[model samples]
Target: MKKRYLVSALLLFSVLSLFIGVTDLTPLDLFSLTEDQAHILWVSRVPRLVSILIAGASISICGLIMQQLTRNKFVSPTTAGTMDSARLGVLVSLMIFTSASPLQKMSIAFLFALLGTFIFMKILDRIKFKDVIFVPLVGLMFGNIISSIATFFAYKNDLIQNMSSWMQGDFSMIMSGRYELMYISIPIMILAYVFANKFTIAGMGEDFSKSLGLNYKTVVNIGLVIVAFVTSSVVLTVGMIPFLGLIIPNIVSIYQGDHLKKNLPHTALLGALFVLFCDIIGRIVIFPYELSISLTVGVIGSGIFVYLLLRSKLGSKSNAS
Candidate 1:
């Protein structure tokens, strides 16, 4: 994947996305725009496009960071209970702080997500075997436990409907004011880039990093903070986009190698491209009625994940032979 190819594809999809909707707007409408058409373009489509781009890119990079820090290809916010914890935080906010603003809710979600991620890492430290497949299975179980707790609370509070909304990732409701919190990811992305080298060093191993005078704990903490904050913001704004973080980086790593700085740009581009492609499919598949982004991505990403597992198994057998 060349940068130019990804950029070109992204632009083409973005233009197409701008023109897609129940309300008819076309390429020609750009030149001779009616008030209604212009409003629709500015208010709904553009913001949705922005949200998709930010959420996709941010989550993918967060996955890359996690995989690096944990040295597990499958580790991600989706697998590691970060999103579940954030959802629990959302439920908590609704239950305890009923009138909390979106930012406040996200703040609470961030704390829970951060805590969940830390706990998962501690679990990793205690595990004896640490098989590639086994690690993520544990994460999946951990996440399910957190999700069940959230669901139980939702049922008790009669907020199950509200909880279900955040469970499914959708872009249909995105508009200018509603999607701005995702902009927080931009600065976080920049921070990830700046600390990319340190993260790479930390990923090598804590002993190796300390041998090189790098503060392994600090870099790892920064990486988790970046992951947690971005995950919470995206979950609150766009809902839980599973596997965006898990698969994109692995795909990039297959072609590009594992160096964090080297793979960052490619990971971000492919993440956005994959999400844009999925969003397009969701919109057109039902014509007027759209499927949620979560459904489309989950269906496709899970297939890719299976393929990766099979490939890993085959490679291991070949090496043994």
Candidate 2:
């Protein structure tokens, strides 16, 4: 019932996002668009909308898979150092392949992200932390360390401003040529859906999964690879939009339960809708001037995160009592 409501809300927001932009486009303008207006709608607005939907859905689904595999609700690309590592990979690409094409940069970034995520998984294996909260805190610290290193390099190479610009997560620049890299996430998301059952079983702990004859390590590696690839593609194409992954999956799981197969579609839908809603609010809140998707999602997602934290705390207290 709640899922239905959320889906409906998401659809409404997506439509609004399509029409509401810096340009003077409304429901009335769609029918009689000037060439310029038509160009803007087709080249800019449509691409931005598509990027937002693909990026949001991909990241949130990645987070859901990570959480299930790790058996921790708080584990996500942002929270688990995956995004930071990918960002570092982007920096490396810029430095090493200064003359490389965008496609080349993306390939290098994807490789680096894959390596970094693998390292994070190894770290998870070595850690003794049994509590869920402690796990994410560890990830936070790990991400910060990587981010710090990336910032240092950006500053030294006189790319700090460029890196900062990329980090802001804006949809305003989503014209046709610039935003196509985001389409890469669509196939990756489908791959995730295909392997949904393996991920769920793997999340049940290595011993249990192995007892059932599932290849736990292989399944986990596949999940991590998908996460790294999706995260890198989105980061390269759209910059970093924080907390969409963490918040969207958590919200979906509340209503749909944790079955990965069942919740995957809901997660993807809610994520797309959530980003579209945020993009629409961003477009209209200041009229011609707009907030970046990162800013809007950050403020809103923080509130939701706080609420989840409180709910978890309360649930724990009740259990103790």
- Best by lDDT, which number? 1
Model 2 misplaced stretches (Cα beyond 4 Å): 2-7
Q: How many clashing pairs per prediction, in order?
A: 0, 0
lDDT of 1 by residue, 1-321 (tens): 788999999999999999888999989889999999999999999999999999889999999999999999999999999999999998999999999999999999999999999999999999999999999999999999999999999999999999999999999999989999999999999999999999999999999999999999999999999999999999999999988899999999888888899999999999999999999999999989999999999999999998888988998899999
* Total clashes in model 1, counting residue pairs 3 or more apart in sequence or in different chains: 0
TM-score of each: 0.99, 0.96
Candidate 2 whole-model C-alpha lDDT, 0 to 1? 0.86
Candidate 1 Cα misplacement greater than 4 A, ranges: none
Model 2 residue 285 distance off true place after TM-score fit, in angstroms: 1.9
